[model samples]
Target: MAHTVTDRKKLLNRVKRIKGQSIALENTLENEPDCMAVLQQVAAIKGAVNGLMKEVLEGHLREHLGAEDLSKDQRLEEVEQVISILKSYLK
Candidate 1:
C-alpha cells in the first residue's frame, strides 16, 4: 500500500518525539530526579507510544482489513489480532 508523504512524515515525527522522551527519561534517572516527576514522564511516554501504535493499527485496518476482496477468514483474523493487541495493552 502506498502511504502519502504526509503520513510518513507524521509517523517519523512521532518516532522522533518518542526517542527524545526516552533520552530525557534516561537523563532523569542519571540525575536522580524526583520519583513522581519521572513516573509522570514515563506515563506520558507510554501514552505517546500507544497513540502511535493506534494510528498505525487504524491505518492497517483501513488499508488491509477494509479491502473489498478480503475473505471472511482474513477479516476475522485481523479483528482477532486487533483484539489481542488491545488486551495486551490493557494489561
Candidate 2:
C-alpha cells in the first residue's frame, strides 16, 4: 500500500531488531546458557514479533478497511482477507 511506504523504514527497523534478538537467542543456545536465559530470549523475540504484527495489522485495517474511497465489495473483500489471515495466524 502507498501508505505503507511512509512506514517502511520504521517497519524495517523493527525487523532488524527482531533479527538481532534471534541471533542472540541462537548464540545463547549454542553457549549452553541457563534455561531461564534461553526462555527470556525466546520471550523477547516473541514480544518483538507480536508488536510488529500488531503494527502491521493496524495499518492494514486503517488503510484497507477504513479507507473512504473503497466500494462496499472492496471493503468486504478486505474483511474476508483479514479474517482468513487471523485464522491462520491464531492457529
- lDDT of every predicted structure (CA atoms): 0.86, 0.92
Clashes of 1: 0
Q: How close to the true structure is residue 4 of candidate 1, measured as C-alpha lDDT? A: 31
Off by over 4 Å in 1: 1-6
Error (Å) of candidate 2 at residue 25 is: 0.4
Residue lDDT tens for model 2, 1-91:
8657879999999999999999999999999699999999999999999988898999999888999999999999999999999899888
Worst 10 residues of 2 by lDDT: 1-10
RMSD of each: 2.2, 0.9
Ten-residue stretch with the least lDDT total in model 1: 1-10
- TM-score winner: 2
lDDT of 1 at 74: 91
Candidate 1 whole-model C-alpha lDDT, 0 to 1: 0.86
